[model samples]
Target chain A: MKILILGAGGMIGRKLTAALLRKGDLSGQAIQSMTLADVVKTDAPASAIPLHTVAADLSAPGVAAELIAERPDVVFHLAAIVSGEAEADFEKGYRINLDGTRELFEAVRRVHGADGYRPRVVFTSSVAVFGQPLPPVVPETQVLAPLSSYGTQKAIGELLLADYSRRGFMDGIGIRLPTIVIRPGQPNKAASGFFSGILREPLAGLPATLPVGDDVRHWFASPRRAVEFVLRAAEVDTSGLGVRRTLDMPGLSATVGEAIEALRRAAGDEAVALIRREPDPAVQRIIESWPEAFDPQRARALGFEADASFDEIIRRHLEDEAPATTVRS
Target chain B: MKILILGAGGMIGRKLTAALLRKGDLSGQAIQSMTLADVVKTDAPASAIPLHTVAADLSAPGVAAELIAERPDVVFHLAAIVSGEAEADFEKGYRINLDGTRELFEAVRRVHGADGYRPRVVFTSSVAVFGQPLPPVVPETQVLAPLSSYGTQKAIGELLLADYSRRGFMDGIGIRLPTIVIRPGQPNKAASGFFSGILREPLAGLPATLPVGDDVRHWFASPRRAVEFVLRAAEVDTSGLGVRRTLDMPGLSATVGEAIEALRRAAGDEAVALIRREPDPAVQRIIESWPEAFDPQRARALGFEADASFDEIIRRHLEDEAPATTVRS
Candidate 1:
């Protein structure tokens, strides 16, 4: 099987690329070739398969067509202007997130029309698609009322992906991933960044700020689980999806208190002491508008799994980031 | 108040224009000027105010900017490719419905940036935004899983409207109108056309085909009521809408049997007898996918009313189209 990964330079993208290379196969077919495209060329990982890394701005006029010309069997579209960036620069957000996604779909559609070349297109949506007035546990039937420009762009992409799939232009599946906890990277300015930072920093023997209250809850999955969800989406039988092509990925719903307890259990009280309670009301208010939990029945039924618990999430982060210092209680 | 109607040549657009002209005011402001734009130049109605009719394709570059250059106080965006046409031709549908709507919003945003020129944008969405696996009465929270390309485009437009409104670029309200019954025109090829044709043709003393079973239910409102919904959208207090700017306009839920019975009551059994039973399975299957009813709590609370009953709907058609031959109870 041939594969193309957009945003292959990002943390999850790089992880996914490595995972594919380690496996050297997808959906039981040997990985014959792979192309990784992003705004900046991704580092070429050592691989036996024919691999190409290209720098392409997807929103540029002819960029999508050029990237799609090779036509891989499975296309993993993970590129996006992050929420904070999208909210700050509205035009740039729409250009990269909305127009860029549409251009990619259009390119694939044009190819589909010429020779019925329908590839498995897996799109990465986000839980940000659900917003205020949300239920305590958001149901699968919850209407998409995105509170941010980034959320709106993702919701629109979901709609387009479904429409394109229904029209026989492509075999597509959209997975609305939860807030990925323990994101293995340096801290960022994202409001939800602390969800990862508090755990990631503490595990790495660094201090992290806790902006929201301990009782504050949010949906989550480890980065490893997120990668697994994408792979499942690529290989899952889509006949069951009908026209509603998007699925809310299964995620572990836990409170900040629960996450901290899990962290302390894994890395001892000393590690947990690294958390500084310096509340930022602005971040708290922004976080409050997000969904805390979801009853993602569809994704669960489709066999997509989440981290067993917050404990497992912390353990996985420790194992992935600091293997030598990893401690299990 | 200066007003602009994007699809002034369409049935609802023309009716809305005539209503605005007849009222001589909107939101208690005196009428000043009006601009009517469409792909074809709309017939200029006799008006005392400065009324300008121009032919413009909203999807075309520079067109939306030109239209918004004057910056009307209220803009009624009722333009779209009909569902049947959109389903048959995908590109044209997205171009006219999705891209055109976005362009208009972008134009407003640019103007709003320069001088804070935020106009009350009344966008006409449709119940087609809801599809199968639907509840008996689709509620305000019903997820928009549009089954057709036209519905998809309208749903996207709704998202853009809400996002733009939330950003303070424009004061926007989207009303999801029901299938308009007794549409005053020659029968078109729309799958939902029969919903109007059975009543419209018989009222005109012509035979009409009934392609579905009598029990096949659907949601509807009269064209007059649809116009009223648009007007209400234009004048209503949008502060209550928050970020979820769209409302499902209240509509009477009735079956084909109920409609035929209402026709009997309005124009007597003579009008009902003109109906012919010719079950076209293709049409039946298409109509079956439509929403049967909606629990539009938001629209109801906002004072957007529906026709009292199917009888009232039929009576209104008589009042509007055939006043000379109209018979009361």
Candidate 2:
């Protein structure tokens, strides 16, 4: 099977690439080749499988068609500008997040129109699609009234995916991932960056700033689990998804206090003390309007799973990031 | 206040034009001028108010910009291809319904950017945004999972309208109109045309076909009430609407059997016998997935009223279509 991964330079993309390489096959189908495309240049991973890496902006005219010229069997579309960046750059967000995805879908449709080639396209959406006035555990059937521009773009993408799939233009599946906890990387400027920052920093003996109170609860799954969801979504039978093709993946729901307690259990008082509570009203106000938890009944029924607890999430971060020195020991 | 109607040639558009002319003003503002645009030429009404009609395709490049050149204070966008036509032609649907609307919004944004010109953009959405396995009375917060291509386009338009409004590009409101009953003029090939035809034809002393079973229920508002909803949506204090700008307009929900019974009462047994039960599986299958009823709590609370009963609906159809001849003693 020939596979293609867009946004292949990001952390999740890199991990997904490594995971695919380790598996060598999907559901016993032999891997023949792989193509990775991103805005920045990506180096070919060390593997016997022939790998092609390309740096291209998917939003640019003809770029998506060019990328799909080889007609890969499965395409993982994980490319997107983060919430903060998308909100700040309105034109850029609609251009890259909305128009870019449409171009890719159009490209795939043209391929099928020319020759009978139907490749599965797995799209990565975000929890940002749901905004204020959320139920404690938002049901799968709740309305999508995204307060943010980024969320609106994702919601639009989900609708497009469903319509395109229904028309038999292409095989498409959208998975709305929860906030990814313990993201293994250097913290950027995202408001939700603190969710991962406090954990990743303290695990490495670095102090991290806390912008919100401990009572701030959120829905989250580990980056590792997120990648798993994407892979599973690609292979799952979607005949039962009905007209609504998007699925909200299950995730661990916990408060900041619970996460702090979990960190203490893993690395003792030292790691817990490293988190400095510096309140910022701006961040608190933004997080306050976000969905706290989700029922995700549809995803669970479809065999998707979430982390058991915040403790498990912290432990997974240690195992994936720095396995040489165990946090507990 | 100056006004612009994008689909001035359609039935509801003609009624709205008459309604506006009757009122002679919107709120307390005086009507200075009006621009009516449609795919075909629109005849000027015999109103004292200055009226200009433009015949052009809004989807064509530069057409939207040209339409906005005069900068009408209130823009009523009620233009779209019907469900049957949209389903048969996918590209045209997306082009006219989706891209055309986006271009309109973009044009409005550019107008705002150039100067301090903010217009009230009242967009017409449809209950087709909701699909099957629906609740008895769908609530305001129900998710949009349109089964048809037309519904998909309308849903997309709603999302864009909300996003544009949120960004302060234009003051906007999207009213998800119920299926318009007793639609005037010659019958076209719409699947839902039977809903109106079953009543309209008999009133005109002609035979009509019933493609679906009598037990099939659906939501509806008369062309008059729909026009009222649009006018109300235009003037209401939208400060309470927040970011979720679209609203489900209240309407009468009755079974096809109930509608027929009302027809019997209005026109007696002789007119009722004019009905022919001709089951078309294709039409039945399509109507089966449509929404039956709606709670419309939000709209009711905001002062929107539904027709009291099917009797009132039938009487209104008669009054609006032919007031000189009485159907009942």
Candidate 3:
């Protein structure tokens, strides 16, 4: 199966690409070729498998159609502006997030209209599609009431996905992802980055500022689990997914204190001591508004799994990524 | 006040236009002119008020901008393809309901961006935006799970309106109208038309066939009441609206048996006897999936009112529409 990954330079996109390349196949489906496209250049995976990378802005006119012309059987759409960036630049956010996604769907429709060629599309949505003043545990039946431009754009994308799928132009599944903990590399523009950054930096013996309180709770899944959810969504039997086109992926809900304890258990006192608590009101407001947990029965019933505890998530991150790290007793 | 009414040829549009003309002026605002446009030609009001009637297809490119360029202080957007028609033609539904509304909003936005011009836009949405398997009383917070293409398009339109309003480009409100009862006109394409037709035809001493069972329940508001909701939505204080853009208007919820009983009370048993019931599984499936009632607390708090009971609603129809009928003891 040939596959294309949009926004391939992003953290999750890069991890997903590497996983697919290293596995060399998906559920016995042979991986023939992979195309990675993003606004920034993407690093090619270290594999003998054929890899093609392209750096192009998708919001430009005709870019969507041009990208789909390659006719990949599977497409992973992960492109989006982060929450803070979207709020800061409203026009650019809508241009890239909403219009870009719609244009891509239109391109797929046009291709299928010309010839009955329907491709499987896996779109990575976010929990940000929800807003605050909500129930403690949001159910699938809860209406989408986004408070920011980023969330609004994601909700609109989900609507478009559902409509296109209902029309039978393309086989699509939108996975609403949780915050990926122990996110590797430099901190991005998302306000929620500190949730992962605090642990990642502390494990590296570097001090990290905690912008939220110890009691602040949030839902999380490791990067490995995120990739697994995406893959399972692509391979699952969609016959049961009625008109509600998107599914909320399963994740572990943990408080900041729990996260600290998990880090201590995984990497000992030295790593835990590298953390400093300094709350910023701006970040606090954002954190307080996010959902602490979700009852994702729909996605769970569909065969997606995640770590049961924050410690397991951190351990998995250390095992897959910084393997040289050991507990300093 | 110069007013522009899109879709002035339809049932509610005609009634609203006539009511506005009857007032001779809107509130304390003097009526300088009224422009009416639709996919087909609209009848000029018999009043002495200056009327400009245009018969142009709004879905055509550039038409929306052309219509908005007239600079009307009040714009009533009531245009849409019915549920059945929209389901039959997906492209046309998106073009007219979704894209057409956006074009008008964008045009107004450009006008506002150029100068400090903002107009009160009253968009008529529908209860169809809510899908089936709902609680007996759906709250305003219920997720907008639309079953039909038309409802999805309306939901999208509501999103766009809220975003545009938040940007300070236009002052807008979306009124989610319940199914209009005693809809005075020929039967059209809506699958739920029998909800109104079954009552209206029998009152006129004409034969009417109900495709669903007596237990089928639906939410309803009279045509006059629907117009009133639209007019009130325009003047209501929208500061508290936040991001919950659409307001579910207050309405009466009645089962088909209750509806028949109300008809008997208002027009006697003879009128009710003209009704024949034959179960249509196709329409029954549609009706069974619709929302039985809406907890329109938001709308009521904003001062929108509906008929006290189904009986009162039926009586109003008889008093206003079928006045010439003699009483049969």
Candidate 4:
């Protein structure tokens, strides 16, 4: 099976590529080729398999047509502007997040028109699609009432995915992932970046700021689990999805206080002391608006899973990021 | 009050224009100018108030900017391709329904940037935004799982409306209008057209076909109530709308049997006998996917009203549409 991954330069994208390379196959189909495309050249290890990388923006006219020419059996669309960036820059957000995704879907549909080239499309949506005035535990049936521009873009994406799939343009599945706690690498413009920073920085023996109160809770999953959701989404029989093609990914629900305890258990008091409280109401308000928990029964029925607890989430972060530092925290 | 009405050539648009002209004002402000735009030239009676008509398609590039140049205080966007048309033609659906609405919103936002030209944008959404498997009585919080291309486009429009309102680009209100039963005029391609045709044609001494069973129930509102909802939507204090700006407009729920009974009451047994039962599984499937009823508490709390019962709906239709063709059964 040939595969194409958009946003292949990002953290999750890189990990997904590596996992695909290691498996050498997907859904029992032998791996034949892989095409990685993004706005910038994505780094990948040299392999015997044909691995091609291209730097292109999907929103730019005709660029999507070139990528769709590869006829990859599965296409994983993960490219998007983060919440804070989209919220700040309206035009850019719509250009990239909304227009870009539609361009990709249209490109695939054109390919289908040529010779019935139907590919499995796995789109990465977000919990950001659900906003304030929410239930304690949101179900898969909750409205797509996003409060942020980034969220609105994703919600629009979900609608298009379902429509295109229903029309037989493509076999599409949208996975609304929870916030990825302990996200590796430098902090980006995402409002939820602090969710990872507090734990990641403390584990690395560096200072990090806590912007909200301990009681402010939210949903989360490890980057590894998120990547797995994308892969599993490709293998699932989507005929059962019916009209609603999107599914809410199951995630661990925990408060800041629970994360702190988890960090202390993993790295001891020294590492735990690195987190400092500096209540920024701006960040607090954003965090408070996010969904705290979800009853993702549909995803569970479809076999999607998550980390057992926040302690496991912290441990997975350390195992993935802190190999050479040897902080033990 | 200056009013700009898009899709002014349609049934609702003509009535809305007439209603505004009759009142000579809106929300206590005198009518200064009225700009009516549509794909075709609209016919309007010469009046003392300044009125301008333009032939324009909002999806066309530059047309939206031209319309926004007038900077009307309240813009009523009642334009859209009906459901069956959208389902048959995908590209045209997105171009007109999704892109056109976004283009109009973007133009308004740009005007706001130039001289703080904020307008109250009242959009007409549809109950098509909700699809099966539905709850017994859908609430405001129901998920937007639209089953058709038309519904998807409307759902996307609603999201954009809410986001634009939240960003302070424009004050927007989206009303999810119920099926305008006994819709005044010839039947269109909309699958729900049968809902009105069974009553409209028979009442006029013409035979009409009932495609679905009498047990099939759905929501309804008269054309008069629909126009009122749009007017009230503009006057309501939107400060309480918060995150969710779109609302489910209140409507009466009844089965085809009740509608027939209402027709019998209004026009006697002879009119009811004109109805021919032709069970069309195709249309039956379509009707089955639609929402049966809704607890539109949000719209109700905002003072939006609905027909008291199915009898009232039939009476209103008679009072407005069958005034000239007076047939007392």
In the order shown, the candidates' Cα RMSDs to the true structure are 1.1, 1.3, 2.3, 1.6
The predicted structure with the larger DockQ, 2 or 4, is 4
* Candidate with maximal DockQ: 4
**Model 3 interface DockQ:** 0.63
Off by over 4 Å in 2: none
For residue B281, give model 2's deviation from the true position in Å: 2.8
DockQ of each: 0.85, 0.78, 0.63, 0.91
Query: In TM-score terms, which candidate is top?
Result: 1
Please list all clashing residue pairs in model 2, or write none if there are none.
B1-B30
What's model 4's TM-score? 0.97
Query: Which stretches in model 1 have alpha-carbon errors above 4 Å?
Result: B326-329
Give the TM-score of chain A, superposed on the true chain A, for all candidates in the order listed. 0.98, 0.98, 0.96, 0.97
**TM-score result, candidate 2:** 0.98
Error of 1 at B38 (Å): 0.8
Give the runs in model 4 whose Cα sits over 4 Å from its true position.
A324-329, B324-329
lDDT of each: 0.91, 0.89, 0.84, 0.90
Measured against the true structure, the TM-scores of the candidates, in listed sequence, are 0.99, 0.98, 0.94, 0.97
lDDT of 3 by residue, B86-151 (tens): 888888888888878878987898788788779889999988777755999998888776887788
lDDT of 1 by residue, B240-319 (tens): 99878999999999999999998888778888899999999999998888889888898999998988899899888888
Q: What is candidate 1's CAPRI-style docking category based on DockQ?
A: high
